[model samples]
Target chain A: MEIIKIVSLGIVATVIIVLLKEIRPEFPMFISLLTGFAIFTMILGELSYVIETLSTLARRVNIEFAYFSTILKIIGMAYIVEFGAQISRDAGQESIAMKIELGGKVLIMVLAIPILLALMELILKILS
Target chain B: MGVVSFINSWLRDIVVLFILISIAELIMPKGNLKKYIRLVIGLLIIFTIINPFAKLFRFDFSLDKVVFNYAKPETFNSWELEEIYHNQERQIEKIYLKKIVEDLQSLIENETEYELVDGDISILKDEDNYGQIDYLVLYIREKTRNNSQGRISIEKIEPIEINRNLEKDFTEYNNDESIKALISDKYGIEKNRINIKIYKKGIGEINE
Candidate 1:
């Protein structure tokens, strides 16, 4: 209904998740997964619309489609890794979560190279 | 959305997850079901605290859209008369709609504002005509940049041939006799308790 409602639900879900973790640790992880999915389902319609509009705006600015998609990809990865990392910590494996995060950072850096190369080429031409 | 996600990039990780879950279930320290349930809940919160970990197993690649959606709606459910809230999910457009309508309604209903404030949402009819199967309309007025304003106006636009300029298909959330059912179904707020106020410029609000 409102943004606050979602927050409350999140809090409740978090509380439930915390209680779940101490006993059946596996169930806690499952609940975490389900909660992640539930939140996504809740806001899917809105995010889709925003992404669609942003894509349109990028097109209007004549930005390369590949460039735009790559940006979305990196963003998508960060979100997933972060979500999973937190769940790991909730499961009391903070070390595992940190490792997962490090891996995500590396991948993002690797994926960003093409964009950097494109920008460098543009700069060289401008200098010429 | 797919028949199979076989051989996808996350396949290895997903299989691992399935295996781990099964193992966790079998060897979960022989605790009470309640404790396990609590653990599940804890896992969820911990999961939220560190979101990026889930990314590794993600093949589709959009965790923000999923995780935030789950988290946001839970917060929104806490408001007074929340039952009256429609489309309770995290619609980004609703944020814009609510803000715009809040101003428009205040201006039109109060009438202190001299300038016209208008906001409208409509669901058109027919697949061939437009995708709007239903409609929502919102309007308001303003006298100046200052906060002083009039009562707001809002309507649900329909495929009516006659009322283009007229604010069509609108009912006050409170006091509208006709909207009793819709209000009951969409927002759980009672139809009678809500003190709905309405006003219009050239024409009055659609009561009948």
Candidate 2:
């Protein structure tokens, strides 16, 4: 998350779009799309690293594979949401952008629903 | 390899999650799905290229693995093994053994209540010369089980073995009562499920 990298990416994006806009208006959208993808990938790079580390850590600790894997998936969902939101913002559709963001967040929580339920079930069984 | 496969699995699972969500959204003449498809594409790029770079900067980018070797009674029975894995959900993976150990990997894979994905179990069968095993090898090719948080009832029935590394410990610690204890202890196996076989190294029968 270095400031320099982020700024450079933004500059590259702007330049790409600017160049693209001259050739064709629709080209700006495609250039922006590619630019947005590049930026999103840059951000996602962090998450993928995180996931890889988590898996390695899991192996190192000799813990259950499923447990950490679930955590990763939850984290992955959050990242996808954030990535979508940023790209959508770049696309300049605030309303649709929010929807993209909102969908990612809610879906992640939903993916986690089963785990949450299992935890509750365990607590109830323990108390009872 | 096990670690990479694990992350890839979760990423793949999320990708599938994206697809399902997109389908459920089912918006007429869906444009948003196309948009999400791009995000999915971005996710692949992130995992392949971006993620490893971050680890380069961190000093203590070390993650610890939980060891099944720590579980007591020399040889691990199923219940204790599962308990260990379930207890340390955030820390280690029991199935790392599953990746290498043939007995356990095949047990869970050959049949289980959970869904199977992205894991392969390769077992090299050993037919003993004097009705005794030469060498048995089980290689885990893939694993995507998420026992702690997922409802994937991965009934991983890893076959039991005396780890060669622990051979000395087994001889030193194995007294008559201990041997009996190994027999009597709960195996996390269902009732009437075990077939008893006694072998003293080669082909000689145990006379006791």
Top-lDDT structure, candidate number: 1
For candidate 1, lDDT tens digit of each residue in B21-89? 353344232311224223332332333222223333343323333333333243224663265353553
Tens digits of per-residue lDDT for model 1, A35-70: 778886887787677667656654543223444444
- Who wins the TM-score comparison? 1
Model 2 chain B: lowest-lDDT 10 consecutive positions: B62-71
Q: Residue B142 CA error for candidate 2 (Å)? A: 45
Candidate 2 is scored at a TM of 0.33
Could you tell me how far off, in angstroms, the CA of residue A128 lies in candidate 1 after the best superposition? 4.5
Candidate 1 chain A: 10-residue stretch with minimal lDDT: A118-127
The residue-level lDDT of candidate 1 at B18 comes to 42
Instruction: Compute the TM-score of each model's chain A versus the native chain A and list the values.
Output: 0.78, 0.65
TM-score, one value per model: 0.35, 0.33
**Model 2 agreement with the true structure over B1-208: per-residue lDDT tens digits:** 9669757765655555445334323421223334443443343333333223333343222121212222133333679668877788523333433443344334535543211121222222344422222233222222344464557676565444423332322211112232223323422332232222222231222221
Quote the positional error of residue B160 for candidate 2 in Å.
17
Over A10-120, each residue of candidate 2 has an lDDT whose tens digit, in order, gives 898788778877777666666666766776677666756755754675555423354445445544555556656655676677887788767865564454444344443
